[model samples]
Target: MRKILHVDMDAFYASVEQRDDPSLRGRPVVVAWRGARSVVCAASYEARVFGVRSAMPAVRAERLCPDAVFVPPDFTRYKAVSRQVRAIFLRHTDLVEPLSLDEAYLDVTEPKIPSPSATATAQAIRAQIREETALTASAGVAPNKFIAKIASDWNKPDGMFVVRPSQVEAFLTPLPVAKIPGVGKVMEKKLAELGVATVGDLRAFSAEELQLRFGTFGRRLHLRARGIDERPVQPDQPVQSISAEDTFERDLQLYEFEGDIRRLAEKTWLATRRTQRVGRTVVLKLKTAQFRILTRSFTPEVPPASLEELTSIALSLRDRIDLPPSTRYRLVGVGVSGFRERGEADGQGSLFDDGERSPDSTGRPESL
Candidate 1:
């Protein structure tokens, strides 16, 4: 069994504020910039007690937790701490896959450390992070990403959970369908209507039957219900598609989405460049207030030569929305795919020249 560990920092931004400032300790803390449009970047366990949450409007968070101390987000500081955490992870294994600034997945099937087992390796990593960073992290050790991610969250604020290979089914069976990754509220309600409230209940339906009802996602649901995920912990994986998205506090019509789209595109652009890769396509993703998801993409004869072209293509894609003009959207995302190694791709080439594409490929995706 491959040993995978998921490490997630507890209340990363708020915890950082608390660690740096003693007075902020024990008091509910929120990370945000002050403004009508500002959103809470993070909330401490203390603040969460009062229903404060990340991505809530700062004004709303303040009203919910009046006693909460607010600190502006310091991404520089967080990035530095993240580097330290990554260094700790590397000491054990090079197969680390970072999910974000505050979380990563490490494959330690053959650990470099003197630790005797996967569980021991996780314990050691968590201990070193706490000792060095003065911050708590939660970790989960399991056979795959699906189980490991869920196990990591089983305990919060500096804890560790483990699921041995033999216990995979037992660990997954009793969980609510909502606990399955990708089964958001909407999917949960649909599953509930089918009496598939738990992973066990979901498993009762044949994979073909579920697929007929849910399309491609039906297969994913079938596999995840059995605690099976074959994704690996790939270190320094090549960047293919870079994207950014946001969920608005209030849904907005298409015209009102222009500013948000541009902002998200800029973020995606910056991220894409950070990978030192070039991309040839722009993709726009949208989710309606009712939870319907749609995506539009364009691959220019020439890759977008500049940010101006990127933004223009993204905005034009919005024009293709055949839905009613009144359709309001709660979320939008912008991405660049069909990435090429720097100076490697020419206008005549395609991203799939490698013979076949892996499901995990982030390169130009096929249009639905």
Candidate 2:
């Protein structure tokens, strides 16, 4: 059996800010740009007590914790810290899959440095991180990735949990169905209607029955209920797509979408720079006030050479919408896909196409 460890930093961005400035310690801290459209990137444990969370509107975060300290993100500093954490993981095992700057999955089944157990490996890694970076991390050691991820979150802020192969089922049974990776509010409600509220309850349904309802995801649910996840810790996974989106506090007319589209386009473009791959397609996603999603995509004759070119192509896609001028939208997104290594030759393709549709239970466009 493969041994997996999920290590997650405690309130990563906010913790970094606090560690650098002692005065900010023990106070509610929110990491975000202060603006109407800005979203919270991270929140300290103190801020979380007031319901502040990442991806929440910065304005709402402020409203939730009026005394919360707001700090703008510093990617350069965060990346440096991430490198240090990754180096520490390499000391124990080379099989490391980073989920973000704050968390990663490590396969320490045959660790570089011998340890008594996988749990011991995790404990040592956490200790090394604390000593090297002065940051606290929580770890979950399990037979596979999914359970490890869930276990890592069991105790917040600096804790560890271990699940032996023999203990996997017992460890997952009492947990809510929401603990399943893709079981969001909508899916959880659907499962509840079927008298399936917990992982234990989910076991009563056959795999075929779940597949009939949720397609491929249903099969995944069946396995997850039994604490089975066969996915390996793949190091250096390539970027398939990058996108940025926002839901407006109030619905917006299509004509009024320019500012938001431009903003999201810029954000998406900046994010793409982190990867060495070049994208050939630019996608524009829109959601109606009633939650109907539509997407438009374009594959340029040449990959967008600069941000201005990308933003122009994204903005021009607006003219292709056939909706009435009276239509209002609740969300807008800008994305790039069809990634290829740098210097790849461009392939001939249609300039425009109606993007494929696959709406998840939450009635939102499914991520690629």
Candidate 3:
């Protein structure tokens, strides 16, 4: 059995805020955007007591915890701290897959640490994080990734939980079916109506019965019910797509959103330029005032010929939408997908594909 551990920082953004500001420590701290339409990014445990949570609307968060100290998200500092945490993980094992800036999954089946035990490795990593970064992380160590991810949440801030190979089944049973990933509130209600509210209940049904009802996903549900995830920990996974989006401070009509779309497309284009690959598809995304999301994509015979062409294509996609002309939108996004490495393309030009003058790709004499 492979030994896996999931490390999750306790309210990462809020904790970083509290750590940087001594006065904020031990107080109800909420890290979120300070705008009417903004949503909470993270909430400290003290703030959570008032029902404040990440992704809750900022207005709602304020109503829940009137006395809460709000701090806007600073991704730059968070990334610096995240690097430090990742460095700590590397000491125990090189097989680390970062889920986000604040959480990661480590496969320490062959630990680099002197201690030969996964539990001991987890403790060491957690202690190092607390001591080095002044932030606590909860860790779950188990025989597989799925179990380890769930086990990590069993404890709160600055805690650890372990599920040994012998205890996997017993630990999984009796837990609500909702605990399984991908089983949202709607799916939970459906399962409840069928008299299956727990993982144990799911286990009582055959895989064939589930597949017949839920199609391909039903087989997945059956496997998840048995705690039978066989996925391996992957490091340095390739970026499949790149996109940037913004939620407006105030809703605007469809015709009033061209500027934001172009700006967002420019941002997305700049981001894509950093990659060695180019995407063949341009996707235009819009979120309506009622929170309905719609997307339109145009995949030309080749990648966008130029940045001007890209921006124009995205704006033109807006005209293809069948929504009411007076319909308002709260969010807009621009993205590119269907990536292909530049090295694999035949006569495909570099970053600026407009047949324009290219940057220096000449011979380099000095070190990189």
Q: Which 10-residue window of candidate 2 scores lowest in summed lDDT?
A: 359-368
Q: How accurate is candidate 3 locally (lDDT)?
A: 0.84
What TM-score does model 2 achieve against the real structure? 0.81
RMSD of each: 6.3, 5.0, 8.4
Query: lDDT scores for all predictions?
Result: 0.84, 0.88, 0.84
Q: Judged by lDDT against the true structure, how good is candidate 1?
A: 0.84
> What is the TM-score ranking, best to worst?
3, 1, 2
Candidate 2: misplaced stretches above 4 Å?
244-252, 257-281, 285-332, 340-368
Which regions in candidate 3 have their CA more than 4 angstroms from the true location?
290-305, 312-327, 343-368
What TM-score does each of the candidates earn? 0.82, 0.81, 0.86
Per-residue alpha-carbon lDDT of candidate 1 for residues 290-352, written as tens digits (9 for 90 to 100): 656777887777888777889998999888778899999887889889898777756762332
Model 1: per-residue Cα lDDT at residue 183: 80
Model 2 Cα RMSD, Å? 5.0
